[model samples]
Target: MKFTHTIKAAALVGIAGTVALMSGCAMSQSGDLNGMKGGGHEYLLTVTRPNQLHVIDTETNKIVRSCDVPGTFGQGTVEPSPDGRIAYVGTNKWEDVVGFDITNCDIVFSAKQSYDNVTVKSFVSLAVSRDGKELYTVQNPTRKLNDRYEVMEPQLAVYDTSAGLNAKPIRTFPVDRQITKIMAMDTGEVILAGNDVQAINPENGDIRILTLLQNWKRGDSWTQPDAFAMHTLGEQADEFILPYFTIKWNGDPGDMEKAEFWWGMSRVDLKTGEVEQGEILPFEFIVFNFITDPTDSNILYGAFNTLSKHDIREKKTLAVHNMEHTYYDLNMTQNRTIYVGGTSSDISIHDPDTLEKIGSIKLPGDQSTSAMRIAFLK
Candidate 1:
């Protein structure tokens, strides 16, 4: 079940014209010196159908700007620059990277990964450097031959953010397969999640597994861990955390019913490059993504069919509130207001302590698995 958008020539021309007109208006507004000041407000960045990047002010829970992003909307994986001025999104059926100036909706940087006979697609693997000077993506390529498709090796492509309009990878290195998410750490390492959690140095391409998921070893009684994370929301907690489920035998090794299903969390500290893993829950439930509280690292929140809060250190569920709909991604503001998004147009807000529904911000179209990211404007 791949999400894609068909491109048409007439629609492309119309979109280009609309962007040009918007750029003119932006320039006119920029000329007013009184309009250029910082409010130090926080905004949520998300993309919706038909190629639109929506920015909502967390304070007002209103759509402040809807930027025109070139290319067809696919995964809509977005990563805001460190300064929060530019937003880079995965679009064009997941084959291109487009960066938009959120203030004016101008296409500042563009990179098409697919060309010629090889079709390259990036599945939710996007990140930006701490200094906002570099961008990273894991490109999975396949060659279309006359007979069949040849699967090629995946590569981690790095791009200079200053490369305007038409951009290409300044450097690319071979990476492991099945990578769905990549995040830049303050320690200058990019953490990748796939079969296993890995940290790769962008400078020399030195890669190492920070934590094992598929290749985990917990004696012969425990089964291999199964985990998947697609959304990038760990910036608030400053740690990339992934939840995994595994089975451990409680009684007889050959007994089927005596198996204990366990849920665990694997965390990588973005600040110190430290790795840790431990059991969070003794049972399993549906949880698409989890976010840790920046002020309280022991507290974590998860989103799916229900919103849940957990105290990982104490190994207890603090709260669980059933949601009206499924939300694939979860994020939090500096003040601890919870926001769950993805799989729909509306981002539901909740109280962090009680998991009570407080407010919601509705977009113009369905998010369709787009990543929900928080950006602070100072």
Candidate 2:
């Protein structure tokens, strides 16, 4: 009984009364529940640079603990609160919020809100709400005349981490673009996708813009091509696929070889945008995120520097698994066995029901950072 959230800036009439009490409620379709028996395994809450939040224990995977996220957090990622005790970290530094402590990982809480002062940065999407108390972040409002895509700011902020340690007040939801994937739907609503993928109601963020495709190709000049990841398998009126990742950028210099660096994956029907017939997931290092198998929502697993798998109803890519060093976020728990963290800090363990590789754990750093997001502290 400790979630004391109170962040406010919201009032679309309480998001239309919580979307009319979650309109019909039946959205529970995210299960394959592999239920592993491996004891206290799966971990890696990392950051390297001058950034910090390390705790890797992927079944003896390594690096027990390292904390101190005072706030410089960027390109956001870190989640907990399904009774895993407490860990809801989302920051862009200025609108800071970080809290941790599930059996002594420390970082109890640190929130700072109130700043519509304008010009803000840092945020690439973060979610945690299904009932783990409350903590959702999505920021995208930059004006550096940028669109080279470094991913940050699309605007969305909601915090109520049980309102503990004086929690609350950072309520916002402003969008026009740049929310790379945010899902906190447990009949509560807030399943935003980006480049343009919407579903909002963080108690009153009330957004509903889902249009599967119109510009997603992803990859070029090095990457920033487009289409990263978005998941919402089913429920709330059934029928949900909505996957993403695409890239395209026509060049013009008389002959830039017609410019096109191919990469694809598509599935959308968010109640009639009807775009089916897309599949393409291969990587040479540039696919930063992908994970779906909250049981078996058609089984999808990606890490785009390589560490892949997707079967979204046989749409394509059943396995891509090529790692001795290459992974940076991959999760599936409720017992479906699969936890992979990367940047060569190494945290691998698979078998998300037959994507089988079985084991790996070696994180304490030797080099390489960013792209390590995992949670499971039962």
What is the C-alpha lDDT profile of model 2 across 18-113, one tens digit per residue?
Answer: 543233111111211123212334454655534556766555555666665666655334555554445555555535667766345445454555
Best lDDT goes to which candidate?
1
Give me the displacement of residue 313 in model 2, in angstroms: 21
lDDT of 1 by residue, 72-130 (tens): 88898999887666789999999999887666666777899998999999999999988
Compared with the true structure, model 2 gives a TM-score of 0.29
lDDT at residue 143 of model 1 (Cα atoms): 99
Off by over 4 Å in 1: 1-40, 253-256
lDDT of each: 0.84, 0.52
